[model samples]
Target chain A: MDQAELAAKFRNKDIKAFERIYSDYSDSLFGVIFGIVRDREIAEEVLQDVFFKAWDKAETYSAEKGRLFTWLLNISRNSAIDKTRSKGFKNKNKNSDSSFYVDILETRDKTEIDIDVNYIRSMLGRLKERCVKLIELLYFKGFTQKEVSEELDIPLGTVKTNNRNCISELRKLIQT
Target chain B: MNVEEYIASGILELYVAGVLSEEENRDVHAMILKHPEVREEIEQIEKAIVRHTAALAPGTVPSFEFIKTHTAGKQVPVRSLQSKKTYSWITYTGWAATIVLASGMFFMYYRINNLQQDIKRAGDQNIQLEQQISDVRKDAEATEELIEILRQKDIVTITLGGQAIAPESFARVFWNKKDEIAYVDVSGLPEPPEGKVYQVWSLKLDPLTPTSMGILDQYDSDNNKIFALANPNQSQAFGITLEPEGGSATPTMDQLYALGVVSAS
Candidate 1:
C-alpha cells in the first residue's frame, strides 16, 4: 500500500499499518538518527523511541500538515538531537565532533559489509562540498535558511536559491 | 500568484525540512493541494532526502518484531461508555450472603478490602510471570534458530582455542563457506574491559593476513553471545582480539584471545 493509505491506517492505530511504516521508513530514520547521535546502539534506541512516540501521538498527525515520512523524519531528528543534549549523552559524547552526514557515508563506505558503498560514494561524490554542507545543515540538521546562510557565510537572500539548486543537483544524482 | 516562480523559490524544500513557520506550512500545504506540479515536486524532494539519509545507515535495520514489542504497551485512551446506574438485586444478595457469613459489617468490609489487595498483588505477579515467559520464549526461539544454523550439513564448525593472552578463553565459529557467513559464539570469552571490545578476524594463513570481520559491541547483553558476521574471505583461520571500542585496523596480536584454523574437509 502507498504511504498515504498506510498513514491513514496508522492514524487509526492499526498494528499492521504501524509495521508497514516501520518496515518502509525505519532504515532511513535509522540513518538520520545515526547521523545525529553518531552511536549505533544509542541510535537504535532513539529510533525505537521515535516510533513509539509517533505511535502514541499518531492522532495529532494530519496529512494536510505534512507527508507521513516528513513527520517521522522530524520526530527522529528531534529525538536524536534531544539525546545529544542530555547530560549523560553530553558527558559520554564530549569527544564526538559535530560531523556531517557525509562523514557517516564515508565511514560506512569503508567499514560496512552489506550496503552497496560504491553507490553512496558515487551519488554523493559528484556534488560540490558546498552543496553537501548546504544540504547537511538545511535538510539533515533542520537548520533554517537564515541559520544555514550564516553558518555557511553565504548571503541570506541567496540561501533559498542556493539550497534549491543544491537539491536539484541531488535530484539529478538520484535520477541517474 | 506565480506557482512556477514560488516552486523555484525553494519554499517546498523548506516546507519538507519542517523549518517553515505554521503560516508558511499552511501556505505550502494549500499550494500543494492547489497545484499538481507543487505536489509532485514536494514528493520528489521528500524522496531525495529519504534516499540521501538512508544511505548513511550503518547496518541492518532492527527487526519489526523487536520494534512492535516496544510499542505494544502503548495505551490507547478508551472513550468511556455511558451506562444506566441500576440497582442490582442479585449483587445485593451476593453481598448480603458474604456479610452474614462473615462476623460483622465492619469486619466483613475489612476482610473484603484485604481480599481485594491480595487479588491485586496476585494480578501484578501474573503480569510479571507473563513477561518472564515471553522473554524465555524469545530466548528459546533464538536458540532454536542458532541450532538450525549449526545443523546445516555444509557448515564447518571451527573451535577457536584460547590464545596465550587468554588461555582460558575459547570460542566457536560456525562457518558456512557457501553463504560466506560465520556465526561466532564467544560465550567462553571473558567480558571485555571498559573502553575495549572483542574484534573478530578472518585470517589467511600463508601471508598471515587478517581481515576484520566486525566488533562484538553487544557482547554483554547478547544472550546467545553468538554474532553473525560476514566473512567473504578464503579464510584459513579465525582469530579474536581485544581492541579499542571502534576496533583496530590490524589485530592487536598482544591481546589476541582466541585463534583457530579451519580443518581441510
Candidate 2:
C-alpha cells in the first residue's frame, strides 16, 4: 500500500497497518533515536516509546503537516532527546565519550548485521567536514538553521544556502 | 511563487527537517499539492535522510511481538446471557459461599504479587533518584569552581563581542596573564556543529598574526561551556574562529566568530 493509504489505515487502529508501518519505518526511526541516545538498550526503549506514542497519537497525524516518515522521525527524535535529558541518562553517560552518529557508523560492529556500511562511509566520505556536520545537525540532530549557523559559527544568512549546497553534494553522491 | 526558485530556496530541506513553523509547513503542504516536482524533491530529501539515518541503526531491533502487544487495540468480548434457571435456595447459597471463598484467596494472591512488583519498581526508582542527586551535586560543585575562577582578583577579563556575522553572539576570555592560562566562557556562543570546534586564537594586532590557543573540543559536553586553555603567546588581542574539528592552523577570516583586544594593563 501507498504511504497515504497505510497512514490512513494505521490511523484507524488497524493492527496490520500498524505492523506494516513498523516494519517499514522502525529501523530508520531506531537509527535516529540511537544517534541521539547513543546507547543500544536506551535506544531500544525509546524506539518502543516512539512507536507506542505514534500508535496512541495516530489520529493527530496528517499528510498536510508532513509525510508519514517525517512525522515518525519527529517522534523518535523528540523521544530520544527527552531520554538524553533525563537525570538517569545524564548520570549514566556523564563519563562517556561524546560521539556523533558518524562515529557510531564508523565504529559499527560488522559481525552482527548486514548493511551497506562501505556505501554509507564512501557517500559520507565525499562530503567535507562542514557538510557532514551540517547534515548531522540539520537532519539528524534537528537543529534549526539559526542553531546550525550559531553552532557552526557560520553566517546566519548563509546557513540555508550552505545546507542546500551540502545536500546537493549528497544527492550527486547518492545518484552516482 | 516561482516553483523552481521556491525549490532552490531550500525551504524543502527545512520542511524535511521538521523545523519549519506551522504556517510555513502548511504553505509547503499547499505547494506540494500544487506541484509534482516539489513533492518529488521532498520525497528525495526524505529518502536520502532516511537511508543515511537508517545506516546508523544498531545490529538488532526490538522483536515485532513486543510492538504488536504494546500497540494492540482494545476489544470488548461479546457474551450471550442465557435465561436464568431456578435453583434451590440452599444450593445457590452453597455456590455463593464457595465462590466468595475462592475470590478471597485469588484477591489475596493477586495483591501480594502486585505489592511485590511495586516494591521492586520503587527500589529501582530510588536508585535512579540517588544517581540524579549525585549528578546534580557534581554539577553544582563544578559550577561553583567555575564561579570561583571567574571571580579571581588576578583575572583580566576581555569581552569578545559578536562580529557582523553573528550580532547576537558573544564570549568572554578571563585570562590569568601571569599564569598563562585563559578561561573561555563560551556559554554565549551556540553549540558547535558536529565536526566543528570553536578555536581560540591569541592574536597580535600590529603584525596580524594568529596563534591557535586551543580548540573547544568538548563544547557541548562541557555543561558550564567554560574551557581553560594554556596561552603561551605574548598576545595583544584574542579572537575566536569556528574551525573544522581538530582545528585549523590559521583561523578562517570569514568564520571568525568573536574578537576583542586586550586593555593596555
Q: For each candidate in turn, give its C-alpha RMSD to the true structure in angstroms.
A: 25.3, 15.7
The iRMS of model 2 comes to: 10.1
Query: lDDT per residue, candidate 2, B1-265, as tens digits?
Result: 4797789878898788887656667889999889999989998887777777777787567877898787665467989899998889999999999999999999999999999988866754554465456558768989998888878888999999998778789999999878889999989987778798999999998879999999988775677888999997888899999889899998999998899999997
Q: lDDT of model 2 at residue A156?
A: 59
Pairs of residues clashing in candidate 2 = none
lDDT of 1 by residue, B24-125 (tens): 677788887789899899989988988887876767888888877866766679999989887799989998899787757778789899999888667545
Q: Rate residue B205 of model 2 by lDDT.
A: 88
Supply the global lDDT for candidate 1. Answer: 0.82
Model 1 residue A120 CA deviation (Å) reads 3.6
Candidate 2 deviant stretches above 4 angstroms: A90-102, A105-116, B73-265
**Native contact share for candidate 1:** 0.61
How high is the lDDT of residue B71 in model 2? 68
